[model samples]
Target chain A: EAEVAQSPRYKITEKSQAVAFWCDPISGHATLYWYRQILGQGPELLVQFQDESVVDDSQLPKDRFSAERLKGVDSTLKIQPAELGDSAMYLCATTQGSNNEQFFGPGTRLTVL
Target chain B: AQRVTQPEKLLSVFKGAPVELKCNYSYSGSPELFWYVQYSRQRLQLLLRHISRESIKGFTADLNKGETSFHLKKPFAQEEDSAMYYCALMPGSGGSNYKLTFGKGTLLTVNP
Candidate 1:
């Protein structure tokens, strides 16, 4: 079974530091998404990419967050000057098209002091 | 704006008992609703979608436009069914594909 891959399953950093999370979607998937989930809450979309182009980022906090899918397969999400409020589970998901079944990765649990 | 509301944050049911996880949404146009489940130490996976209208793992959800709800229900619950479940909505008309919204989620604890 093909599954999405995420690196650094767990990360802890102090406030004002920078953090990055990586995600490799299932092979041949064209759509990728990044989401943040606080403890006891559902995941919220941060950014979405379709074949290397951003589809939606209206919810993304542009001030400190950035996401990219250069080749349209793998993606990276970065947060600079991370704050305590930024501590959450960073999840990556993928689908073949805009309105297809989404597959999610194991996620990267980030903790910022 | 699209919003999903899951009133209950936690639900505990005995094994073999009937279980109902409430999910409600607010959208003007036709919407696509889905149920995602996450077991212990596992990634989130789709349990069922309203469009499919097929029951999964003995769970079924009926989309009631008048009520604006798509609640998941199972006639009999099992211990292995304990997990966190989320109700997601993809507004059909004007909402973008990537603008899906999810509720806070409900933690179902099926006691044996």
Candidate 2:
């Protein structure tokens, strides 16, 4: 069974440092999503990508966060000057088509000290 | 706007006992409901969807549109069935941009 791939399973960074997380969605998936799961909370949507274009980023903290999927396949999420509040498990998910079931990656746990 | 609610934060059941996880949603348009589960050290995966109308691993969920509920039920729970369950709602635009809203999640523990 093919699964979504994520890099840097765990990351530790000093406050105000920059960090990046990568995600490769399952093959043939067109829609990708980035979510942040804080301790004891459900995953919260940060951004949504329809192919290579961003569809929704209302919840994303644009001041310090950015994401891109240039080829409309894999994606990268970067956080500049990370803060203590940025520590969370970042999860990436993808769907085959619209309204389809989402497959999630193992996630990258970030710890901003 | 769409929202999902899982009332219980944790539920405990013994082996061979029946289990039910409560889920409710609020959406104006037609909604697609789903249940996602995450076992320890494993990625979150879909347990079932309302549209499929299929039972999986002795679990089933019926979409009650009138009541806006999609509770998951499983008979004869096993120890291995312990995990965190989340209820999700897909209320995004069509074609693409299918953003999903998830609930806080309910942790199920089945003891022997």
Q: Please state the error at residue B89 of candidate 2 in Å.
A: 0.4
Question: Ten consecutive residues with minimal summed lDDT in candidate 2 chain B?
Answer: B91-100
- Give the worst 10-residue stretch by lDDT in candidate 2 chain A: A94-103
B-chain TM-scores per prediction: 0.95, 0.96
CAPRI rating of model 1: medium
Give the DockQ (2 decimals) of all models. Answer: 0.73, 0.87
True-structure lDDT of candidate 1: 0.92
Q: Candidate 1, clashing residue pairs?
A: none
TM-score of chain A of each: 0.97, 0.98
lDDT tens per residue, model 2, A55-91: 8999999999999999999999999989999999999
Query: Per-residue CA lDDT of candidate 1, range B1-112, in tens?
Result: 8899999999999999999999999987899899999999999999999989999999999999999999999999999999999999986763346456899999999998
Off by over 4 Å in 1: B94-96
Q: Model 1 — TM-score against the truth?
A: 0.97
